[model samples]
Target: MREALIVWGGWPGHEPEQCAAIVAGMLRDEGFQVHLDNSTRAFASPQLSTMSLVVPIFTMSKIEKDEVSNLSKAVREGTGLAGFHGGMGDAFRDAVEYQFMCGGQWVAHPGNIIDYRVTVTRPDDPVMQGIGDFDYHSEQYYMHVDPSNEVLATTTFSGEHAPWIKGVVMPVVWKRRHGQGRVFYSSLGHVAKEFDVPQMRTILRRGMVWAARE
Candidate 1:
């Protein structure tokens, strides 16, 4: 069976454990042998290289150098990396290498917890297949994303919160390649319950599976 490791821990505000549980259940249903933990030590395990996917649910936390190296190497060697919201995007802010692997970093969320629309930019992509534009009420993430990302969905700023970025179109969901590994991310879930949204949940599920090694 393909293996997946979900390491979650950081700001309690993001409900890392709860979010991890939800995703873990989904991964299990998808036929992956999932391992769940709340420490970054899992990143350094010899088995990381053998795993199919790594989901880091840490937010605004510090990761050791060795842990980063191990994780980066595994992903580069074909282990997939996938995550959502601040868990992956805002994690390890000081670790530039980790951010490079992720292809984006959470810079801000204007109007913290507000209503917004997520527009599907790539309807034909398998990860977004069957999904349409949806409405959501949460932190509309204003991220600093890598230009190389293959953006699949986007959200337009209304300028209600940040005037300077009024017409900014930010990527809400994206997939990219880091070495031979597949990297997928979405800035949709601010908390566990946000995944309750059918479209949000479905997109994440498909994205995770798509990121995993074949």
Candidate 2:
């Protein structure tokens, strides 16, 4: 059976483990085998080559060296990486290797948790076929993104938070390749309510499938 190694935990504020379970169930429904872990250490039986994907729900911290190396190699060689918001981006900020594999880092989210809109940049992508530009009430993120990344959706910065941060556009959802592996990220998550939105859930569900590198 097709399988995925789901690594989650750290910072209950981001609800990484809980969210990972939600996503894992989604994959299980799709008939994929899943291995779940909520540890701050390395994978015990990690043979990156055997998994179809790696889902990290970790946030703002350091991970063991072995886990980082295995995950990096896995994605670089070809297992998919998928997660939303800070769970993946805010993780291991000091680890350049991790940041390099992640493609971007979370600098600041100026407006606080508030309402904002996301416009699809790659509307033609299968992950966004039925989903159109939509608005939601949550933390509107403002991040310094990777220019090499393929941005799929973006949000405009309004002068409400930082008048000086004007004319900046942030990618709310995107995808990029790490060697032969595919990676996907979305900045739409902050609170549990964010996951309840049909648009958010659908976007992530499709994104997971897309990131699975099938």
Candidate 3:
């Protein structure tokens, strides 16, 4: 069976633990042997490279240089990486290398919790197939993204909260690669309950599976 390691912990505001549980269950349902850890130290495990996938649920946390290095090396060597929201996007703020692997960083959520729309930009991609544009009620993440990322979904800023970005199209979901690894991310699921949203959950599910090492 494919194995997946999930490391969760950081700012409680994002309910990292709760979100991790939801993701763990999702992976288990998909036939993956899931392992969960509440500390970033798990990233340093020698076995990390053997796993099929790594999911980081840490938001705004500090990671040791060695831990980040090991995590990056594992992914670069072919272990897949997938995650959503601040857990992956806002994690390891001081680790620029980690940010580069993630393909984007969550810089702002203009109006905090508010309603927005998520538009599918790559419906033909396996991760987004059959998913249509949907209304989302959460932080419309304004991110600093990698230009090389294969953007799969996007959202337009209305300038209501951050006027300078009015009408600017921001990537909400994307998939990219780091060496032999597949990396996927989505700026949805501010909390565990967001998993109840079919679109959000389905997108995350498909993205995770798509990122797993074959």
Candidate 4:
């Protein structure tokens, strides 16, 4: 069975624990030997090097240099890393190395929680296969993404909330490589309940599977 690690905790408002539980359940259902941790120290575990995938649900938290280094090394050596929303995107804001590995960083969410549409940009990609443009009522993330990322889904700002960003297309889902590892991220799922949306749930599930190293 593939091994996976879920390290959660940072911002309680994002419900990191709850969101991690939902993803953990999905990973288990997919035959992963899921290990759950409530601390970032888990990233330093020897087992992490052997993990097929690592899901970091830590948002707006600080990570020690060694801890971040260990995680980076593991992913660089082919341990896949997958996460979503501010948990991964906005995590360790001061750690450029961490952000570099993620391929993007959450910059702002205009209009906070608002109605928006997610467009499927690469429907042919396996990570987005069977998914279609869907309606979402959540924070429309405006991220600073790497140009090299392969964006699979996007959203356009309506300018209703933020005038200057009106009509700006932002990536909603993307996959990239960090060294030999696969990295996948989605600017969705502000909370665990958001996964109840079929499209969000499916994309997250498939993305995790795709990011897992063989």
Q: What is the lDDT for 62 in model 1?
A: 94
**Tens digits of per-residue lDDT for model 4, 95-172:** 999999999999889889999999999989988888889899999999999999999999999999779999999999
Q: Would you list the C-alpha lDDT of every candidate in the order shown? A: 0.95, 0.80, 0.95, 0.94
lDDT of 2 by residue, 59-117 (tens): 88677677677788878888888888888878877777777877787888877877778
Model 2, residue 98: displacement in angstroms? 1.3
What digit string (tens of lDDT, one per residue) describes model 3 on residues 52-171? 999999999799999999999999999999999999999999999999999999899999999999999999998888999999999999999999999999999999998899999999
The residue pairs that clash in candidate 1, if any, are none
lDDT by residue (tens digit), candidate 1, 1-214? 9999999999999999999999999999999999998998888888999999999999998999999999999999999999999999999999999999999999999889999999999999999988989899999999999999999999999999999999999999999999999999999899998888999899999999999997
Residue ranges of candidate 1 with Cα displaced over 4 Å: none
* TM-score computed on alpha carbons, candidate 4: 0.98
Error of 1 at 154 (Å): 0.3
Error of 2 at 166 (Å): 1.7
Can you tell me which runs of candidate 3 are displaced by over 4 Å?
none
Taking all chains together, each candidate's TM-score versus the true structure is 0.99, 0.94, 0.99, 0.98
